[model samples]
Target: MIGICKSFGANKVLGGVNLHVRPGEVHALMGENGAGKSTLMNILTGIHRADAGTIMVDGKEVTFKNNKDAEEHGIAFIHQELNIWPNLSVLENLFLMNQPKTRFGTIDFKKMREMAEAKCQEIGIDLPLDEIAGECSVGQQQMTEITRSLMLDAKTVIMDEPTAALTERETDRLFEVMKKLKNKGVSIIYISHRMEEVFANCDTITVMRDGQTISSRPTEETNMDQIVGDMVGRIMSEYYPARTNVPGDEIFRVEGFTQPGVFRDISFNLRKGEILGVAGLMGAGRTEIMRAIFGVDPHESGKLYFEGKEIHIKNPRDAIRHGFGFITENRKTEGLILDFSIERNIALPSEERLAQSHVINDKKEFDFSSELSKRLGVKAQDINLPASTLSGGNQQKVVIAKWVGMHPKLLILDEPTRGIDIGAKKDIYDLMNELTAKGVSIIMVSSELPEVIGMSDRILVIHEGRAAGIVEHKDATQTRIMTLATGGE
Candidate 1:
């Protein structure tokens, strides 16, 4: 794509952006969320039209009419959000519309199974063909999506944050697949926020900021500092800010939290002005425990104490009423209503407090949400715009802003910075410190060990649904936490 430009009304998303990907190369597209990487690819795949640009395939200018047209031209896009049908079987999902037909024109189940099994074996992935897609782990679902794209024999594959949901093992497998595809002369456009993955796996790196391409270089030639500087337009002297707030007395406690097969014997406590990091591998029951604690799910046996008083949290409303806030990991589905305006989303939880005599005060609601949005540094032209109009980083801020408006004594953040950029991550870290300084306790669950070490006053490692050990911030290291997270001493 050369000189690509796109605009959404007054918002110019991509401005003269240029990208070049070579055959058989793994090119990493680095950018903060909403930096036009996805927009450029969407143009390439015919999801959206560029106001002005040129797309040349094999030195020939071409235009794709739709995603299917792009696929037919050997270009496939695997979005950051995996598109999977929960009720369908893995095999069914794999060949949904493109299934083989028998001599009599009936669907050929045997042929589909054989082809799927062959593809799985070729990629070194083991998937249950008949199992419900929803029953599969997130990693499995991710692999299924990749396999679907590969089945089209796509020459150029655009993968957006493919490793966000994968475990270390799964990520390694994905890297191996990328290497194999490269050997076969297939180009991969890898879009991710994980700097380590980019430097280690990619052959080239391209950085975008504010809808424009800032720089592109071979992976070996550029360092992280330069790339980060290009991304955020400044040198980030500190990735994670220092915390000045000293933790006070215990504010919340969970004892013997059990949910039968999901999690067992989970015990932890949160102190006032503390940021407790929950560290564990994927599917280690970390998210499950958080959901149970927030009363979104049931726990067979557990005791929750708020301010030293026993509290029975039967639902999320109960937890919220008792000053608990939860920022769910899947923010797109659980955290905010996408169709609602940003102001509405920010004011959703605080309606009761912003009301008088069972009637909502519109001015009070708008003023309250607007204040919180600005405090969180939410970038938007108008708060009246739909929540879906903002970028991933800003959406996360809105989620946090809503919870902050409630004045929660304890907040639960599950993968708070999962799909956001480095600048946004720093912003959130700073916000956490600010909240803790004001005496609001936080329990942060994250897969990134570096984040846990950098932000947490105390790190709690969960191994196979059990608390392996708790390490103080001074004692927390990647090795120590990994050892504990994997059932080591």
Candidate 2:
């Protein structure tokens, strides 16, 4: 893509950007949130037409009318959000648009199964072809999407945060598959926030800032600090801000929280103004424990206390009534109604408060949403735009704003910065410090070890549905947390 320029209404997202990827090379795209990386890719894939640009494929100028046109040219995009049919089997999802048919005009189940198995083997994945796509793990679902692209004989594949939800083991397997593809002369455009993944896998790096390209270099010619500087347009001395609040009295406590086949005997305390970080490998039950505590998935047996008094939280409504708020891991699916406007999504949890005699006061709702959105630094031309129109980081801020409007004493954040950029991550960390200074207790579950170590006052490492141990911030190290997370002392 050359000279790609795009705009959403008055907002110019891409301004004459250029990108080039070599065949059989894994090209890494680095940028801060809202930096136009997604916009350029969308234009290339025909999701949106570039206001000004030219695309050349194999030295031949080409125009894509839609995603199908791009796909027909062997340009496949595996979006950050996996697209799969929950009710369909893995094989069915792989062949969703283009399925093999027998000579008699019947579905070729036998041939489909064989092809699915072969693709899984080629991708270094072990997945059950007959299993429902929703039942498969996140890693398996991601692999299934990649398999679909490969089946289309995609020559240039674009992967957006493919390992965002994968475990360390699963990520390793993905890297192996990427290498195999590279060896087979398939070029890949890889987008990710994790620096380690870029340095470990990608051969070349391209950095973008604001709406234009900043720099492009070989992986061996650049370092994380340099890349971050280019993406954020400054030197970042600290990844996390200093904790300013001293712990006060215990604000919330859970004892003997148990869920059959999930988390068991989970006990923890959240003191006033404390940021309690939870760390563990995937499937270690960190998210399960938080969901149970928030009453989204109530535990089989548990005792909850707020300020030394036992309380029963039968459901999420009950939990909310008790001054508890949860920002779920998957924001699109659980945290926000994408179709709703920003003001509506921000005021969703506090509808009753924005009502007068059961009738919503539009002025009050608008004022409250505006206040919270500004406080969270949500960048948008109008608060009436659909929530889906915002970038990933801004959408997360909307979710946080929604809960902040409720004025909850305790807030739970699950993978709060999973897919956002470095600048956005710093913004969230600063926001956490501000929230704690204002006396809001936080319980954060993160897959990133560095984030857990940097932001937490104390880290709780979980292993196999059990609490391995809690380490203080001063004592917490990546190695220590990994040891405990893997069932070591």
Candidate 3:
């Protein structure tokens, strides 16, 4: 990494950026979600410092005064939000901040569980070193934070979107532990927005646009439409829109839905200008059927409807007075309230829609949160800052413009562009085709699968919460939605 300029004040997020990784190949870097690839990996792990650039390492010229001086020069990282510490253990999160001592000074727990069970068997990470890293699964707490950065022998690791919440058999055991850390020569870097995990496990790639360094090639001659036409100069067919449909009636239904250990017999319907995607695999309940249809879990058995009536949502303020709006899938911990702003989290469900009818209109809630924050462009430096200071693709467009100023006819969303990037996933697929051309009615919940086969018109899939069938968005097929999202052939 060299000349990696950065800025937040005037927002030049890493403009002079340049990077190179080699030692034993991998490279990657990529772009799109707020470009600048996590500000050049938080300035190569010193956790933000480069107001300019120059880092070097192995060729020497380094500077990381933090992240334990970039893990004592071998560098480390992991982080696409998994920082670990879920009530510890997995051998205390693989040696919490480099432990191991005891010449009677104590704290070496049998040489850190014999080096975290021999570095979780040299990274194939099958778990169980005294368990409880929050009792596992989020792809085993992201491979125990990448096996606690190779038990501190790191040598340039990095990672970031490590299989955006995994499971294709846990991302083929993390590409067989990145091919045994590139046959032990080490280097990595990686970071991704998933062009099939940088063309199946990078051997170079780079890209990064808007914040500079437009190309770096050689993943066998760069392709994925030339790294998305050099990271969004366009041409990926104007960034995916096609999934057309014209269904209308049904509105929203869900019969027989149970929520026992999490799911069972769930059903579906969702029409009236529909979208519907859903697909599954990670705990296959597809975020517990959008948290049991937005009432936030309370489905011991179910049936819900709208156009044909039958409602009783019972909680998220009776599913926002039966209009419903969800968006969830961890947009900064269950969708924003982050120190509030961006027009006070887009005027908070208009405070129970104006404290239960009439009289709380601060200029019509700042003109309806400045007209849905300029119809969802939402950059920042106004609408009152905070929302934990924007940019994770503008904090996921302020969590879909905080439920699009709560108008909702039936939105639901869930994994809305999960870890964001491809130019903020094409401005969230042009704000879901302008909220399905304003008639509204979405349902989405996705684990990518080509974005539920490029924005559904009826896909469904699900598996352990039942309805494993639905298809027809022109007879979909990511191998038939991975054989109905894992119930298989």
Candidate maximizing lDDT = 1
Cα error, residue 196 of model 2, in Å, equals 1.4
* lDDT for 391 (candidate 2): 84
Candidate 3 per-residue lDDT, tens place, 1-489, comes to: 778787878867776888888887888888776677877887888888988778888777878877888888788888787777888777788778568899988797988888777777766557877878877777788877777787788777888888888877878888888888788989888877878877977898888887888889889986787788788787675557774547667877888878787788887788776888888788877887787778877787788878887887857878988778898876776788778777878778766665535566676677878888887777676887778777666777878887877878888887788777777777777777677777788888888878877778878888876778889887898998888777876
TM-score of each: 0.97, 0.97, 0.34
lDDT of 1: 0.92
Query: In model 3, what lDDT does residue 456 have?
Result: 84
State the lDDT at 17 in candidate 3. Answer: 82
lDDT of 1 by residue, 213-264 (tens): 9999999999999999999999998899987889999999989999999999
| Candidate 3 wrong stretches, greater than 4 Å | 2-4, 8-22, 25-37, 41-51, 55-159, 175-177, 184-186, 190-255, 258-283, 291-319, 323-325, 330-363, 367-379, 383-390, 400-463, 466-489
Query: Residue by residue across 1-489, what tens digits does model 2's lDDT show?
Result: 888988888888898899999999999998987888888888889889989989998899988999888999999999888799989998899998788999999999999989888887887777778899998877788878877887887889999998998889878888998898899999999999999999999999999998999999999999988999999999887888888789899988889999999989999888999999999999999998998888888689989999889999888999898888999998988999999999999999899999999999999999999999998888788999999989877899999999988998899999999888998899889988988899999999999999999999999899999999999999999999999999998
Candidate closer to the true structure by lDDT (higher is better), 2 or 3: 2
What is the C-alpha RMSD, rounded to one decimal, of candidate 1? 1.3
